[model samples]
Target: MPTQSDSTPTESARLLGRTRPAVRIAGYSAVLRTRALLTLAVLIAILCTLFALDISTGEFHIPLGRVLDVLGGGGSRAQRFVIFDSRLPRALTAVIVGAALGLAGAITQSILHNPLASPDILGITSGASCGAVLILAGTGGATTGIAATLGIPLAALAGGLLTAVAIYLLAWGRTTTGDHGVMGFRLVLIGIGVNAALLSVVSWLLTRATLTDAAHAQLWLTGSLDRSDWSTLVPAGIGLGITLLIAAASSRTLAALRFGTDTTRVLGVRIQTQQALLLGAGVIAAALATAAAGPVGFVGLAAPQIARRLLRTPGEPIVASTLIGAIAVVGADLVSRTILPVDLPVGVVTAAVGGPFMLYLLVRANRKATL
Candidate 1:
């Protein structure tokens, strides 16, 4: 090896140039990470503000200070009762449900390579709704005692899982041979068919149900947090927590999967296996959230795309999407209670926003295809 002093100017500059790109790339990576962290912090702050507003604003409005004090264990009993007993559960439910939907949407869109993909469109939400509706119809809409607390959610979870299994099985065989895993196009088409069939089942159930039962079922189907309590919240929250951990563990694979199946397989990923695992996690998240809030619409479908745009990321940013989802639901719930003449279900507000967003996505995709 030659001594450093013996090297010519050209050799030194060539060596210097070789190292510069790596240094520059590292700097860019650091900047991107910082930007992502800052985005997450801002989203979290917004989510907290929305949560407080939601908790404080209701039929008997509680001030924000009192709300914070009560949360910190320093308020009057009435304030505590109102915050902890009544408003807190509903608001907390919105946060948890929103986070879950965001995770589901992010993962689904990433794995499928489709911006338009979401739990709602893939029949997962419909399955959960069907399960809950079936229970309501069977009980003549009088879900009281244990039924109210445990029955509906359990049914919804079962329904969602069953639907996911069906979609996975139906689409798995249709995937083209190669390193590629489940084909996104096939899954979407199959999911649409399943979704249509499930909707028909729901409609038939609604029609055959008694008038009172139909009314109750319809309300639940619209997705309301009015029924949220400690009983309903605890189990769903636990499930979501577990699912979140699993999702975080699998985040690296999801990111790789977004690069396309061939690339993912080249990275030594078991494409189909990983896809199924991630899809299962996403499905569970959506189901549990739906169980808690009765199929709150479009949060899953919209949150990831919104978060991706906000962060200016190439693909959906999972953590940011989760935070945005929580914010959207909390904000929507607050709007439903305060801005509207009558309290509408939070799902109504989400659908109003998501419908147009979906159409825009469809039109954008078509334009891309035509071009």
Candidate 2:
């Protein structure tokens, strides 16, 4: 009945031992890995579909077939113009900026061991917003033209980096002798205070500026893809690529750090140095995304948490969060353009969605703490 006799448990174990052990894992872990991969694949598919749809259903209303033809280099001149000149740039920017914010969020949350940690909440985005508002005010609200386009990103980057430095210093000082690493709660509290201060600064600038300048600054602060084009996309994409490489190289360190400072130190990682390096990478990523899209709200805050919940993982899934961030932005941009009576800024939609979700997280965390 048994062909060559069924192997015993011992025999099977011996056979497995003889095979490559590196790939072997427990059944539950294997299942989780498979699920995560499948989830990522599904998210990718969804994003691709949304991307095509985004290019398809603008004011001109090109069909999906024509969009594909244009993408494939086989469309009419007008079709090509509409696809390439008008719509494609915005879609690409949304995806790129979203992914950047997502990665930044993942790094911040993982490193700090706090689900609520995000660049937006940590004053980084507010800092970028402050820089952008300064530029708008200084230039008399000249948000268009060549100079303004180039200037905003640089200012935002500087502001974000400065804010990051400030936060690091403030959080570091609160660290006692017993505190082996940055305290997540302390860092978050300091960040919130900094965020409030920066927002006050932004508000003050807006009030002092002329009406036109104030309006322009307000629009940019709300986050929109109106400014995105080849020029913006190229530099932002490059920055994202560089930061992503740094994050990838630091993946093992990130993984270790997630287990807390003691475990990471035991694993021979220099705690403060590794944390600083990772935080720097996160700041650059957030700044780049903010520079491109003018501090798109709630994306960096929500993406990693959504991905972690989707994958049911203890730690944030970096790739999944990145994909989810792209999806959220692209989807929000789509809704902003098509579903509304008037075209609205992308951040408006995201804030609307993310606000309630954030409340839910706070409530859940409170309940857990009580329990």
Cα RMSDs, all models: 4.8, 5.3
Q: Over the stretch 103-124, how does candidate 2's per-residue lDDT look in tens digits? A: 9999999989887899999999
After the best TM-score superposition of candidate 1, give how far the Cα of residue 324 lies from its true spot, in angstroms.
0.8
Q: Considering every candidate listed, which one attains the maximal TM-score?
A: 2
> Where does candidate 1 stray beyond 4 Å?
1-32, 144-146, 174-181
Question: Number of backbone collisions per candidate, in order?
Answer: 0, 0
For candidate 1, report its TM-score: 0.89
lDDT of each: 0.86, 0.86
